[model samples]
Each structure stands twice: as structure tokens, then as C-alpha cells.
Target: MNKFRCLALISATALTLMACNPASDAKPAATIAAPLSATAATPAVTNNSSGKIVVYQAFTRLFGNSNTTNQRFGTAAENGVGKFNDINDAALVALKGMGVSHLWLTGVPHHGLVADYSAFGISADDPDVIKGRAGSPYAVKDYYSVNPDLAVDPAKRLDEFKALITRAHQHGIKVIIDIVPNHVARHYESLGKPTDVRDFGADDNTTLEYSKHNNFYYVPGQAFELPDIPAEFTPLGAEAHPLKDGKFAEMPAKWTGNGARAAKPDFNDWYETVKINYGVKPDGSYDFERLPADYANKNHAAHAAFWQGKELPDSWLKFRDITKFWLEMGVDGFRFDMAEMVPVEFWSFLNSSIKLQSPDALLLAEVYQPQLYRDYVQLGKMDYLYDKVGFYDSLKLLMQGKGTSSEVLAKHAEVADIDQHMLKFLENHDEQRIASPEFAGAAEKGKPAMVVSTLVGKAPTLLYFGQEVGEAGALDAGFGKPSRTSIFDYVGVPAHQGWLNGGKYDGGGLTAEQASLRAFYQQLLKFSSEASALKGEFVSLHPLNLTSPGYSEQQLSFARFDDKQQLLVVSNFAEKPVSFNLQLPADLIKTWQLSAAPVVFTDLFSQHQQSTNPAKQHRLTIELPALGSVVLQRQ
Candidate 1:
């Protein structure tokens, strides 16, 4: 079901249930027992060069917008869109205190917005083709400019965005921007494009179905037609739109973004965009030469060397120039949208060229196919890929009380070979909120999951802007729906907006429960970022403690060891207390090379101590509260 309509049904069901049992709407005392404001002060934050890497994903336009009008399908004038000037020194300092190492500023690049910029010599995007009044961030209209909606002065948008990058670096956090190379808006025009660079379709021959040099595929003797709108859908929801008619102007219609070759695409298809040609023929054959098998093991420099003398396609060079332009502008890296749709060879060329310019530039891709994971990382030179098909989906099932904790271990084991290259995240722009009714239905349920996801591996961790504050995505955005945050419209996030606290960047007006939840997230993120043992070898303790007393299927246990210290982590996902004898495997002790000695173990999180004589057998009795996480360190 569409997320927006699905939320309407959810809302009706909730209202009915509330009416049926009025008393059930009251908050449970157990979960609502936090102080009205956070009592304990956070520790001082410093730049730790060797800490666990963390990425904070913030929607560029929503981060500093304090407007609460929240008009559905609201215009910029009504809702007051956040500008690049809003993210000031206070914002970066707050993010640094949360242990953020990287800042992913989504929707920073210039895209199709409904606002009229005709004064700046920019054409207005048609409402029939745009997703919302603000438009989808993926529909790139100009590759070399920043979104004017995010700047204090529309003429100085690019300069304002660069200043934000500089501000992020001052707080010891790197920056990442989106690079949507798979497609472009149907009316792609680069008004601010470089003088030497040509537009996407400048030289394309529209007469042929497929050509080695053509930038797009065209259907001869056909005119572009709008998709059939559903009976219930409206362009602006009872508001007048000047360009809402079902007509667009494109002679010899090109293929849709999703490879739909028909002149008229389905409403469900990505009809607002057109696919970019990457030398792949209509029969799914590659015209460009594939990289050698040995290139998989070679560094990016070697890969760059192999492509130096080759005659690359026009699309390939254009994208390379686009990425290079951003890299030069101080964007630390990129998150490629729908990366798998484009050929891996093009990525090999693009990424290698990227590394040739800046070796430390991060490259993350959204690739769902498991079979192509290694190919994309190894041959495509991608630094990380989303773990949605396995780890994320499995965790969601467990959170909804439909699966066991052992399945999480199994999911990790399945991706053991590529675990270091698979980034883990509890929430992002694409997923439902943990506190939403469609997911776990409570923010507290995400505690154990977040603990494991952050400390489970060497890969980087990600936290969406409002996740720590338990922002339930329940508002009805114009085109996007509830459950997941609206990437298509202009709206303010309630929980995160509270954290903004009217530009103070503190939780000034949050309820007791929210304060406590934010505190929990703060402690967990800080601990994960500073722990030394988390960067070393890991072994699953769950396999050895399954049969122990008081152990259940809702418990997960693991150990990480390095040369100087060893850490034992145990998390309880159930609603009841658990007391169990967690046994350290004989093999684990032998691997640690410990002689017959009494090891003193200290709980880093709870400040409890225990001494276990492992001369004969290695075991310790552990007590964990409901939804608890224990991190014990042995020195």
C-alpha cells in the first residue's frame, strides 16, 4: 500500500481502539518515569581520531526550520523552509557532542523545486511532474549548483552550502552529499553549468532506439504523455495549480528512469525522470569493456591506470566530471542513489577517478542485490553498501516480535565476509520510524537493537536526525506518507524540532520520557564511539550460553577482544529481568591465552564488578533488566 493512504487506515484504526478502551490510552508508568528534564550533564566532547565512525543524516531543509505551521502540501512561504544559514555554530557543536564523525547533508544539491525562480533565469518545474511542492531530492535539474530553497540568498546558494561544509569541518565532522547518477529530471537543464560542459541531451540523436554515443533512448515519432493519475490523487489537494494539466512537451519521448520504454509511463513508475545511458544496449549488453579479473584485488590507483588510455563514453566522462566537481568543492564523499541500476564498470571508472583525485573520499551505494554485493564493493570500488536485504529486514522482524534474537547472529554470520563493508543503521530517510505503529510501536523497543547495531562490527554507524528523539513519522506529507519521514515535501519533525529548542540546540521543552530516551541515546553513542575493544576481534557468546539458566531466545551475547582489553556484551530484548550463567567457551579462553588466574571483570556501563576464577571453567552469572545492555571490560 502507498505509505500516505496506509497511514489514513492506521489513523482510523487507532481512533477506533482509543474509543473502545479510553483508559488504555494512558502512558505506562514503567516507560514514562524519566525526569521532566535531563538531570545528569553530558561529559565534555573532544575529537577522537581513533573512535568508531558515525554518520548523522540530516535533511538539509528540515534541520533548522523552526516553523510549526505544518500546512499539508505547504508552500515555502507558509511553512518557512530552513535555509543553509540556519545550521550555525550551535548546530555543529551539538552534533559533535553526540559523537558524530560524518554529516550527511541530504537534499543539498539543486533539484526540481516548485518555487518559481524565473527571476534567476531558472525555469519552474511542472507540478504534474514534481512529487511535491518542494519536489523530490532525487530529481536533479542542475548538477553543479546547490538548492536555492536552502539558502538565505538564492543567488548565493552555492557559497552558503560551501560555508556549511566548512562549518562541519570545524567541528571535526566530514561531509557527504547525494550523487544521483542513475537518472535526471525529464527537463534536465544546467543553467549554472560550467562554460565548457554541455547539457545531457545536447548531442544525442533522437532517431535511434540505441546508440553507442547517444545520451538517452528515444521512441521515434512519439510525444511524451503524462501517466494516468489515480481517481483519488490530486496535484495540489484542492489547491489551484497553473501547470496541473496532463500534458508535457517532449518530442520523440525518451525511456523513463526505470527503463520503461513506452511513450506513456505508468503512474507507479518513476515517470518524472529519464534514465542516463551508460553504454549499455537495449538488449542488456555492455558496449564498454569490463575490468580485468585482477582489478578486483588492485587498489584504486591501479584501476585508474587501466582506464587512462581507454576511450570512455560521453555519459561516463560527464558523470566523472560531475563527481570531480563536488570533490573539489570540499564534499568529503557521496551516497549514490540506486547505484545497482547503473553498470558496475561505470562505477569502477567513476570511483577510481574519484580516488585518483582524493584517496580518502567515502563512497556509499544503495545496492539491494546480495549477489552483486562483492562485485560492487570490490570491482565498483564502493566503500560501503546498505545491509537492507539481510540485517535490517531481520532486525525489523525481531523488533515486531515475529522473530528470535538468534536470527540476528545468523544474519551477521551470513555476511561475515563483507561485514566490515556493510553499513548498519536503525533509521534513515527510506525506512519507517521505530516508534511508529507500523513498526515497533514504541521508541524504547529500539534500545537493544541500536546497542547491537552500533557495536557489532567495524563498519560505520548511521543515525537519522530525529531518531534519537523518537520522532514518530505520523504527519500526512503532501506526496510522501507517514511511518517514514517525508523526503518529498516541506515539513518540520516534531521530536527533532523540540531538540532544536528554538535554536538553542537543547532539549528545552521535551517531556520526561523524551528526555530520558535522548539521554539513553547519548550515553550509548558516546560509549560505542570511545570503546577500544569494539575495534578488535569478535566472537559470538550466544552460541555457548543458549542452554544456560535464565537464558531465553530474546537474549544476545558476544565478546570482543584486543591486545590490551576484552569486552563482554550482553543484551536482553524481553520485557522481564534475566539472570543467567554466561559461560565463556574453553576455546575463547585459550584464544585469549590466559593462564590459570582470577580475572577481575568490571561493568563499564553499570559500574559493577565481579571476579571469576577461570582456572577450571570460564563462566559468570549475569543479571540484566528488561531491554538492558551490559558492557563488561576485563583488563
Candidate 2:
């Protein structure tokens, strides 16, 4: 069973045994819990005009391969200390190497039901899953409880976790966890069964008539519809679609005159469980109350019931509360899951609340694609979402040899128009491997193209697991068990390509190809860290409209500037040699500099650079090889 759903069912069963039944005059679950409110004070926020900007590599499923000298993701063996501390220790070292300011350890709060358990080819009996399988931490079974396997002691788990946060803070590094308030799963019962719970909205009895629900959902003839009236609910089905258009008759019948649907998931599993009317159909399709046997089916009625209830459940309050609780535990921020699902009224309250509790706490949303940003940010006041703009599509184009390197630059600029976000990446637990058959060809240029993703524009870069190293994986990373891919199904690594393949073997260095790629990236990352790069605004390069078919025309140039510093970036997307002219903002010509071999550029990684003026021939013209780019600066 889905762990969180099971846990919730268990919680309700316990509550029913203790709280209500013979209702009316008995004291209720309490009013302070009434109306729904954030559990913590809002955090303080800065106007954030622009300070020393920093980069945070979302190292969620990507960590691990750490020892006392290194830090691994899910290993119970702390690097001579504890798990959190170990992650903090190893991460700091990596940050120093990459010069990153923050580290968003994706969904670190009590989470589990790791994807590899089902996806990475391992039978449950296959010890690898037990060892390597930490289900997606976002499938949270318990908000207050930390994952036992993640902690040395489940009893005092939060304390150790807090220590971990404390240590990371000492390093000047902040952390971010993932949050899920949408449809919770089956495990971790204290929250209650999401599927069976009552949804808010209409007075189904008086409105839609629970008189209908009264008959089959409960004590014979007890209808299971919601309290409010709306569109008739949709029952869960094997597939997610309507057979065709307007085929209302083909829809399934939810009631069929018996308590069948209620019996399926065990309605009594929840103390407040109630089924809703499905209207009528030959095969169910639109009922919010009914659902197919598949797990995590979105229950519109449950959401409706939640909206109707006079007092929000303790668990609901805990959703936002845990963020603060964890912040107190030393967690730096949150990466919310399915952010769009939760009603915005709730989040508006949450954003305001978090500010009072932990001012320094950062918030990241796991929003799908780019279109969803305006609703969340403009109205919801969210901080960041994953950048999926032209990323995957662009990578496909190049590997097929249909697009030039410059296309990557175009895509980045496209995504930035929506938001100066945390640039989402290709390595997360959700996406397929870029080298897999589903994406780029086997040559794996996807990795380098992905490297280009980190630097193409004005967004914060987010690197998911396995992207840095070339780990072989399925077209769908979240698919299923026992050895097809050959990675560790354990909690720490994917089955086919564990840490060794990820290139952090024995603390020395990575594989040769991995090393070369690493060098290239380190250079990009090194420059990205420069104070000017971190805090500057972008200006277009506007290359001349050259009609000649040379490589220089395939390039796109841009500049970043601040009151105190300015840097010009030229990225040549051409695959052949091309000559281009250097066009600088008029005033910059007097102080600008030129670069040569190994590219001695003034950036965060290096200091001491001088400028020189050349004759007209050299002044306006420059030469660049196929597939290359350069950065120049103003003295």
C-alpha cells in the first residue's frame, strides 16, 4: 500500500476509537484548530534588490558516495558522525570546489517510498532496494516523523537532523527541503486517508442529496456523496481519459446499488470517510469521489470536504507547520511538490506565515513546466520553480544534428522572460536520462548540452542526480525493479548507475570523461560565481545581421552589468569557423580588455587581468572555432 495513505488510515482508525461516534454534545477536536491557519509565524523577507547572489545545486537524489571524508545521500553510516552532519560535511567540500552558496537537498523532511523501489529493477527481496531504495522523499508518510533509515535513532531523529542543519549553517550554506500539501499518499497514517476523507463545497445531502449517498456508502442506504454540490464525481479508472468526446453513457456507474466502491479501499479505514454520488454512467469517468485502484488518485471530493469542514485537521495545519518546525530544526528552506494543486488562499496564508517564523528560510516550488509560473508567482508569491522551457526539446534538436549550439542560448532567454528562476535540469528522479533512447542519441552529448544549460542565461541552476556524471538509465527514471539497468536499487543510488558510475569513487577523482566534463563545468561554475556575474542585470549583445553562411552568425552575445562591475559574454553556437565584430557599449571601449590562451579572464576563480587596445583590424574583428564561447570584462 502507498505508505502515507496507510499511515493516514491508521491515524483515523485510532482517532475514531478515541474521539467521536455518539456525537452532538461531546467536546469537539478543539476550536483553536478551527478555520485553517499556518502553524508558524511568517518568516522575515528582504527587499532583495540584489546582494551577493549565490548558486544552489539542488542535490536531491544526486548525493552519496561519501565516506567520513565524503558524504553520500542515504547511507546509514554517517561520515564518522551522523547522516545530516555527513551530508553537510561532504556538501560543503563540494560547494567549496564549485563555489556554490546554497544547497537545496530536495525534500529532506521525513519522506520516503523511494521511486527505485518500484522503478529501478529490484524485487523487494532484492537487498539492493532495501539498501538503496529511499522512495521519493516527497511521498511523505509522516510530517513530524523523520525517516528512521535516514537517522541513527527514529526517536530523536529531528534532533540529529537539527544538528545537521546547524552544522550546514556554520558553513554559511543554507538548505532546502521538499513540501507536499496536494494529494498525500497512503502510508504514514497520522494524517488520515486522503482518498476517503470528506471534501468541502456543497451540501450534498440538502444540495445534491446525501439521501443518495445514505443508501449504499454506509450502514445500508447511507449515501457517500459530499456535503456540497458541484459536478458529479469521477470514479477512478484503469486509464486517465474519457473514451471519446461527449460519450457520457459510456461512463461507469459508481453505485450499482451496493457499497462496492466503499469496500474497495476499506471506507472504515478512515474515521470520517464518506463516498460521493457519481451521477450515472455505463462506465465511471467524472466522479471526484470514485477512483480506480491505482494509488494517489486525486480525490476532488476529499478536497471539497476539506474545504467544507469547520475546522481543519491537525495534520492539515501541520503541513505548513512542519516547514517552520524543520526550519527550527535548522532546515534552510522548502521545495514544495505539486504546488498548483493546493488552493492559493492556503499558500497566500503560508507565505505570510513563513516570513514571521524564519526570515532566512527560502522557498522553492516543484512546479511543472513553465506556463504555471504566473499563477503561482504573481498570485501565490512563490520564489522559484523548475526550468523546463526549451531545455529537453533543445537537447533533442542538437543530438539529432538539427539545431546549433546557439539554440541553447535562445531557449534560456525564453524561459527567463517568465521568471528569473532556479533553472530546472535533466537529472532529477522524474526525468529520463538524456543519454537514454528517449532523449539524445547514445553519444551522450546531452551531458555537455546540459552543461550549457547551467550558464546560458539569468536563472539559478538546479542540477538533479546523475547529470554531472554519465549514469546509464531508463527513458523514464521512475519506472521499476531487479537489474535491467544494473544500478544499485538501494536508497542512495539508481540501479544501473550507482555512485561509482556517478564518478565519486574512493574520494580521489572521477572517470576520465567525467573529469573532462567536470573541468568544463567547473570553469562555467567558476565564472558564474563572480561577484559581478552574481549581481548583474542582463543586456542583449545584438550581433550584426550577417547573411554570409559562416559560423559567427550562429553565435549570440549578451552582457551583465552592475554599478560597480560589468562582463560581456559571447557564446558561439556555430559548428564552423566564423569571424565576428566586437560591439561594446560605447563608453566601455576605453576600459575594456581582451583575452588569449586558456582564456585568462578576470572572474571569481582568478584575479589579476589587464587590458590592451589594438589597431582597427583587430579592434572590430575576432575569430572563434566551431562550438566555442568566451567572456571578456571591463576594467
Candidate 3:
């Protein structure tokens, strides 16, 4: 049975039993608790802070829009797009106050959108090839130009973006932008590239199907045909336009972005983009040199030196130059889209070049395969990889009450060796919101998962904008449905607008529950950013507490420690309040150098006090509310 049905059955039985015995002391089945208010007090933290990174991702088009007129398939003018200037000083200050060390400004580059800027010498994108009115951000139209829709003056868009970067730096936040290497828009053009630089496929031999110099894989003698459109759906919501007829002009079709080799891709395929060839031939043989087996242990600098004299593919060189252009523009780092799709050898070259220029540059990738995690991090030199398929998936099941804490512990063990390189997050632009009916169905369910995600390892934590305020992504902004905030259309986020508060960047318009949720996130993030033990060693306490009284697989416990500090973290994924004796194993106690004397344990969030003598008893009584968590520091 599904979790929802199981929960209903249990609750019904509990109510029946309670009716039979009026004097019973058993509490009712737990319901989600109302969150604390805005006036809730934050916990005090130590000054011995470690470099625990927290990244806040904001969709550039939706972050600052306060307009409530969310028309389905609406034009930018009707829906009102957010501008670069809208992310003002107050916004930066608010993000920094939440312990954000980096701000990933998504969808900043000029992409294929269904808008006309003929005055600026840019042609409009055809509706047949665009995903939505705003188009997909992954389909880059120009590598060197900023999106004109985001600027007050279309001609000065790049300058406006640079100014935003300056503002972010002033508030001690580094800037990161998207860098899509595996594909480009089908009609890609670089209007703002450097004088000496050549655009992608500019020097390609289109007649040849497989050449080291060719930019894209082509199907010879085949004319590109548009996919059959659904009768019920129309491009741009049936709005009359010149290019709405199911025809996109491409002769001798190239492969689709998802590597669809057909001349006509399916309607569900990534048909808007053409895949870039990175020296891997059509027959799956490498056209470029492969790395040696022993090179996995080598550092990035060594890999850089190894490629100094070797010849590389034209596509590789083009992407390398594109990255260099952004680095020169003071972009602190890049979030690579589909990094695993490209060869690891190319990453060794590209990432090493980036690190050589800016040693501290952050290189995060979207690689999901568990088998390739170490290759991308250790060999490809990526600083961080998304922990989606493993850690995040396990937590999602646990939040639904359909999975056990033992399963979570096992998943952690799979990547224990490289745990520090895996970044953790519960929501992003691609995932369903935790507050949505499709996921956990309540914002409070994310509290315990958030606590575990932030404190489980030494890797960075990612927070999507509006996640703190409990945005359910319920807007039906055409082409993008509910359960996920739209990235493909012009829309306003209601919950986020409450925090925006008419550009005040305060929670003035937020409800009491939302304000409380934001306060909880603030306290957790502040402690995660400043705690030294979070950056140190970790030991799971699940095994030791499995058979203890009042303990069940619904609760998870762990410990983190370093030379200067020690911490204990526990999260309850149950529907009812959980009371357990969380045991500290002898080995862990020895690592902390604890004596037989009583050691006081203070709850980091509530300041609730408790104590246990290690010699007399190796356990501490823990009580957590439904879907609640606690982080205790050893004193």
C-alpha cells in the first residue's frame, strides 16, 4: 500500500481504539505541527567557523517579479519579467543573512526565446522549436551575450549583469552561472563573441558526418522534419504567429540534444537543441587520446601539463575558449549542465584550464550515475556533484514514511569515501517542491530532511529560492504545470512575492507559518555555516540504537566531530512523536575523549537541556515532535 493509504488506515484504527477507552492516555495520531513565527529566537553559535558552503539558487527571470497577473502562456510584457536591476542591495543582504556563501544566478545567458529584438539585430525564435514563450535556458543562442529580456536597456544587458555581479561580491557572495557544453540551440549564433573568436560550428565541414573538426553529428542526405504536435496543445497557446506552422528550416539534420539520431525527433525529445560532438565518433570510438589508468590519482595541475602539447578536438577548443571568456568577465564559477554527457577527458582539459586561471573557481556538475561519481570528481576535477539519485532519493522516501532510516544509512555508505564531494539539496529548478501534493504534501515534512541533508556530511548545501518560505510551485504558468516552478514561461511565484514585499526584501507580507518556517531555515543554516564539527569526521549511530527501547527505524542518529568540537544529530521521520535512547558507541565516546562524568547536551534549536554519564549509561533520552529534528553539541 502507498504511504498515504497506510497512514489513513493507522489513523482510523487509532481513533476507533480511543472511542472504546475514554480514559486512555495515548495521544492521537500526529498531524503536522504549525511552524514557529517570525519573532522566534535564533540560537547562538560559536565563532570558530569552518568553510561550510551554502549555495542559494535563484531563477533570474522569476526571483524579483512581484506581478500577480500570471497569465497562462503570457508574453513578457503581460506577465512582467524581472530585471537585473531588481536584485538590489537589499536582496543580497537578505541572502547573506541566511548564511549563503554563493549565489547561483540561473538563466542569465542569452537563450532561444520567442521574443523579437529586431532593433538590436536579434531575430525572434520560432515557436515550433521553443519549449515555452520564454524558451528553455539550456538552449543557448549566444555564449557571450546576456539575456536582453533581463535588462532595462537591451543594448546594455551585459553591463547590467556585470553590475549585479559587483553588487553580489560586495555582500561577500560569489557569483555562479550556467555553462552548457553538451549542446546548443539549433539556430545558435554568437552576436557578442570576441573579434578573434569563432562561433560554434563556424568552421565545420557540414558535408562530412564524422570528423574531428566537425562541431555537431550530422545525418547525411536527411532533411530535418518537425515532430507531430499534439492536437489538444498548440505552440504559444494557439496565439497566431508567423512561425507557428510546424516547420523549422534545417537541411541535412544534426542529432538532437538528447542524442536522438533520427532526422525527425519525437515530440518529447529535446528537439530545440543540437548535440555537440566532443571527438567521440559515430561508431563509439574515441577520436581523441584517452587518459592513462594511473592519471586518476593525479592532480589537476598535472593533468593540465600533460595536455600542453597534445592536439585536441575543435569542439573541445571552442568550449574551452567559451569558459575562458566568462572567467575573464569576473564570473566566479560555472554550473555545468549534463557534464557526464561529455567525455571525462574533455573535462580534465576544461576544468584544469579553469582552475589554472582561477584556482578557487567552483566547478559543479549534474552527474547522476553512482558509478561515475568518483570519475567526475577525482578524474574530471569537478568540485561538487549533485547528490540526487542516492542521498536525496533516500530522504524523499523516508519523508513519505515508506522507507526506513537503515536504508538511508546504507545509501550513505555507498558514497562514504567521496561523501564530502557530493552536494545535498531537497529542491532545485528541476525537482518537485517538498510542499507540493506530489511530494511530501506539507512543508513541515522537509524540516527533518533538511536537518539531515545539511549536517550529514562536509559537502555544501543548496537552497532553492522560496524553499525557505515554503513555495509549493502551484502556479499553472502554461507549458509548466504545478508541483514545480516554471522555468520555461513568464510567471510570478506567490510565496516568494510575499517575502519580496514590494522590493523591501523582507518577510512583511508572509503569514505566521511561513515566517516560522523561514526562521527555522535561518537558524539551521547559520549553525551549519559556522559549526566546525560539520566539516570533520562522521559516524552513524543507527546500528547501535536499532534495538534500544522506544527506538525504531523511523529515527536516524549520527555524530560529527573534530579536534575542537563534537556534535550529535537526530531526525524523526515518523508521523507521531518519537522518544528514543540515542546511544553513543564506546568507540565514538573514546574519539571524543569523554569521561564517566555527566556531559551536558544542549539542543541547538530549542536550547533544551539533557545529560548522560558515558560510564554509567551510553545513551541519552531524546524526544522529537512529529517530523522534527535536533542538533546537539557536546559540552
Please give, for residues 1-635, the per-residue lDDT of candidate 1 as tens digits.
12210111111111111111111111110100011111111111122555577888999888888888888888888876888878888988888887888899899878887788888888888877787778878889899898999988888888999899999999888999999887798889998789999989889999987787788888889998988865334437666667767688889998877666889977766677887887777766567777775676777778788888888778999999999899999998999987876777888889989987987787888876665667777778888888877788888888788888789889888877777678899998878899999989888889888988888886778899989989998887666677877877788888888888878888886878888888888877877677767667889999778989799778888988777668888888887789988888888888877667777788867789986667547678889988887878886
Q: Return the TM-score for candidate 1, rounded to 2 decimals.
A: 0.91
TM-score ranking of the models: 3, 1, 2
Model 3 agreement with the true structure over 474-584: per-residue lDDT tens digits? 987766668889888899999889999988899998999999999999999978888888878999999989888877888899998888888899998887998877888
Q: In model 2, which regions exceed 4 Å deviation? A: 1-62, 65-90, 112-134, 153-156, 191-316, 369-371, 390-400, 403-418, 422-426, 435-437, 441-452, 455-457, 474-509, 542-549, 552-554, 572-627
**In model 1, which regions exceed 4 Å deviation?**
1-48, 231-235, 594-596, 613-616
RMSD of each: 10.2, 14.3, 11.6
Q: Put down candidate 2 lDDT per residue, 446-539, tens digits, no spaces.
A: 4335434554444555654455555445421121221112122223333213323333332244566655555555566655655445344665
Candidate 3 has a TM-score of: 0.91
Clashes of each: 0, 101, 1
Please report, in order, the local distance difference test score of every candidate based on alpha carbons. 0.77, 0.41, 0.80
Using TM-score as the yardstick, the better of models 1 and 2 is 1
**CA displacement after TM-score superposition, residue 3 of candidate 3 (Å):** 24
